[model samples]
Target: MASTDAPPLDANRYRQDFPILSSVLHGDQPLVYLDNAATTQRPRCVIEKIVEVYERQYANVHRGIHWLSDQSTDLFEEAREKTRRFINAPLREEVIFTTGATGAINLVARSWGDANLQAGDEILVTEMEHHSNLVPWHQLAERSGCRVKFIPITDEGRLDLEQLPALLTEKTKLVAFTAVSNVLGTINPVVEIVEQAHQAGALALVDAAQSAPHGRNDVQAWNADFVAFSGHKMLAPSGVGILYGRASLLDAMPPFLGGGSMIHRVTMDGFEPAELPAKFEAGTPPIVSAIGLGAAIDYLEDIGVDNIHHYAQMLTQQAHDVLEEVGGVRFFGPPPAEKAGIVSFTLEGIHAHDVAQILDQYGVAIRAGHHCAMPLHKRLGVAASNRASFYFYNTPEEIDALADGLRAAKRVFRR
Candidate 1:
């Protein structure tokens, strides 16, 4: 378990480290960034690391015999090591890099799902899953003739763990779920769910895109079979992510994408796939993006992820309190105590888009609409909701600005 005893974060001071945080928007308004669940702003260290890579050591990895290739390969593999430690996976070889979390999920769905699942086999996913987690399995089901089942969500936007038992059966081959809901912000019990999947004789896959960046993440502690998260969500550049599969499972599964790097030997008759990670990481990997993720991990480690988690929680609760004071704001998802630093709400008699536009006028950034979880939004009984997600760099004053923006939006809509 992650220690919650770290010193609280100092957002006021840390804000100086992010270049984009110093920007002004819409004339004179300061940019109040609250859309962290979508993506995070990069620190100067991470940005500088990317620039250094491009200027000094940019080259294709593991292909050429030249010195540059060796240098690039070393850096690339070092990034993989950083990812392995970041999630506390037992083996570095278990970590596979891909385009993003969506790509990782798709790789698992096609590579493992196609090989293992049969016509009567079942894939269990939660209703609050982002479309990336849902569509991959659905596609796998369509191809392999397997059945897809949903673990329902409660009225409070939490997984109905009581219904989980009835949902799992012998036919269930895999249980894929989100560690945290992108829309609802509900933090699901990853360890508990992984254990349940094991008991039911099914493999477990966790979509950690939302939670991995915020707190301590240990795949061994969770006893999970597969865990996936994106670099962009965690302050790295876009287009790079991680998939950590148990070595035993990965060794048994075939490669998802076949290309030059993923093959050990290509014959006129057939081709043999490369070992553990390379099997999934076909073609050239995202070299610079992976290094950026490693740098981002370094930045987070220095500050302490537990501290980030704690302060984000404080900001979340503050948002709830201030938004509640701003009447007509109906919050979705569990109360602040039960969730992370995400507050999704719908203002009475106002469309989410209009609210987002009004908030932008005040230079407050927030997300509006289903937020890539259409089913979760439908469960909340709203067409769309305004989401204000906080990170460790956000300040209390920004939450106040969010409330002020909502008040302004309400005044405009009421007229």
Candidate 2:
């Protein structure tokens, strides 16, 4: 069992680091932000770092000898190194900056898939994957004449691990899945999945968008061929994500995009691509956003990932207990203790959209929709559901507020 008594953290002091959390929503109500699974609030350190880069070191990197350009280039490379360490990649050169998780997944589908896959080859994914993880493999399958397969998911929203051995075979080219379900909050056994993929002679890719913020991630331990996660979901700015691939795999895969820095020589016949990460990062790249991500990682490190994980789990459990006491609410995902920081459910006889609107009046902000995991929602026999995702800064008082809002919603809809 994970320890709940994390090193003493000043929640109030840490809350001060996020400016948005201090703001008044709808004129007077304190914001109870439960949409963290969508995007986390950026800390002041991250915001300040992004602002500083544009104000102080705004210049194109990698090709200029001027002071501003040199400084910008250095900062950009430093950010890459920071990301490398944050995910525990073997080499900094393996960290490729992407527009976001979607872009990173697409890069793998286009570059690696196109290079390695052929007709009769199969790319196996899970039924619980977000659309970002699913569509890329589907497109890759269509383009490369490869087939797409799905590992079965249980009624409880957890992957059926017992079914994995049967799903994987010699024809399997890659196995991609989410580390945590965006809607269900099921923490998939990534290490076990990786081992299964390797035993079947398939590459493993993990979509870490939902897991990276909550715990320490070591791709080395999982032995994943590629790992992709967005910065915005981890309290960093939008427009930046990290794609961590094995150095050999990244070196061998063809470039996903063609443009400025991704090329070594552009002849009339063909263009020679740059090496590793540069080959994948085609354009000028997200300079300021990368700096913000580095600062976000720094902020998370200061608080300690273990502390964040423990606090979030406590908050999630509190939410589960409160919601369970409510008469009309029906919880989804693994039982409260087995899941991560996300709680998703539906209210009896209430549309999810209606639930969201009613909750807004109390300033209890919870997300209500398909949450970009439509197939998972469909498999669970629901069109949509409400989701309340917690972070380290969230409190028990906020959970009470959410319960009050849900009660109010039930009363409003009961008529």
Q: Give per-model TM-scores.
A: 0.97, 0.97
- Give the range of the ten consecutive residues with the poorest summed lDDT in model 2: 1-10
**Clashing pairs in model 1, backbone N/Cα/C closer than 3 A:** none
**In model 2, what is the error at residue 150, expressed in angstroms?**
1.2
**160 in model 2: Cα distance from truth in Å?**
0.3
Residue 30 lDDT (model 2): 91
* Model 1, C-alpha of 269: deviation from truth (Å): 1.5
Candidate 2 lDDT, tens digit per residue, 1-415?
1334643366778889889998787888899999999999998888888888899997988888899999999998888988898899989888999999998999999989999999999999999899999999888888889999998888887899898999898999899999998888888899999999999999999999999998878999889999999999999899999899999988888888899999989999999998777888888999889978888998999899878887888887888888888878888889766667999999999999999999998888899999998888888899999999989888778899999999998888773
Q: Candidate 1 has what TM-score? A: 0.97
Q: After TM-score superposition, what is the CA distance of residue 275 in candidate 2 from its true location, in Å?
A: 1.5
Instruction: Indicate the residue-level lDDT of 37 in model 2.
Output: 94
lDDT by residue (236-350, candidate 1, tens digit) is 9999999999999999998888897889999999999888778788888999999999999989999999988888888888888888899998888888877778999999999
